[model samples]
Target: MSAWLRRLRPGRRTWLRLGRDAAILLVVYAAVSLWQTRHLASGSAPALAAHAIDGSPVSLDALHGRPVLVMFWGTWCPICRTELSTLQALSRDWAVVTVAMDSGDAAKIRAFMRERHLDFTVIADPQGAMSRRWGVVAVPAGFVIGPAGQIRFRLVGLTSSWGLRARLWLARGGF
Candidate 1:
């Protein structure tokens, strides 16, 4: 009888401890996940000014009542190139803006656009002011802004058509 009691006690204690730990961890994970999701969904669009390939001033004010897709990238990044192609193809129904991050020489940007026959507007952010304002520390970041100047979706790196579609859908007030 004594031996059986000891065996049962140890096993029960072990399982109880494990269950408590797992429950705590799960709660913490759920809270963090909720915070992240909410944080991403609740921001006004970063008010960064735009610039032309020649470094002249440009305004996003025209996009006030329309959806806007802002893509951050560098000419040297292959992922950026792919994203550019995808965006170019999808620009017919959406307003797309591609801002290159310090890829040097505006001519390079013009050349790349012309070579690809991309009709989307391409801007050069040589000073990185716009990049910093957008909280873009990495290349190939994307933001889909709603008509009210709110950022509905944000992509940190290279993304797919499905991702863009989902973002646009969200921007359009869809789930």
Candidate 2:
């Protein structure tokens, strides 16, 4: 074997240390995630029935037969902006309903949606009343509602599209 290759190989002890570190990091990440979502809504989701910015009616109760992704976000939130595409993509395969928490009036939200080319159903919560009922104090909060109308997962902050997809799939399976 070449000297460089031999030098690049990690020893058994090094591998063990790396594994320990990874485990610790995972624990820390999980703890933080739990802490961040401590105040989020749980149990049965709050009643959400409103008109989308596009004039279509939206209601969480109507989507009870299938898992639904309910997201609370704002146009001013950069993290929420980054997740727009993810939410839009998920809407194609699953039911997605978003609350624009204090984003703006219906006209402004409609403009933002047009600019981003997003077709996801968005209900404007200009006064944040809907978000308050959902216990969402932060932007970019997400909930995976099971087919039985229970909240299966509460996610705070940014989350990967695949992670959300997995949660939706799990919810569908009655998890």
Best by lDDT: 2
* Best of the candidates, TM-score: 2
Question: What are the per-model numbers of colliding residue pairs?
Answer: 0, 0
lDDT of each residue in 1-175, candidate 1, tens digit only: 6987888766777999999999999999777645543423248876656677756665667778877888889988888887877888767777887788888767888887788887677788777677777777777878899888888777666678777866877787776
lDDT of 2 by residue, 80-102 (tens): 99999999999999999999999
* Error at 151, model 1, angstroms: 1.0
Error of 1 at 75 (Å): 0.4
Worst 10 residues of 2 by lDDT: 166-175
Model 1: weakest 10-residue lDDT segment is 33-42
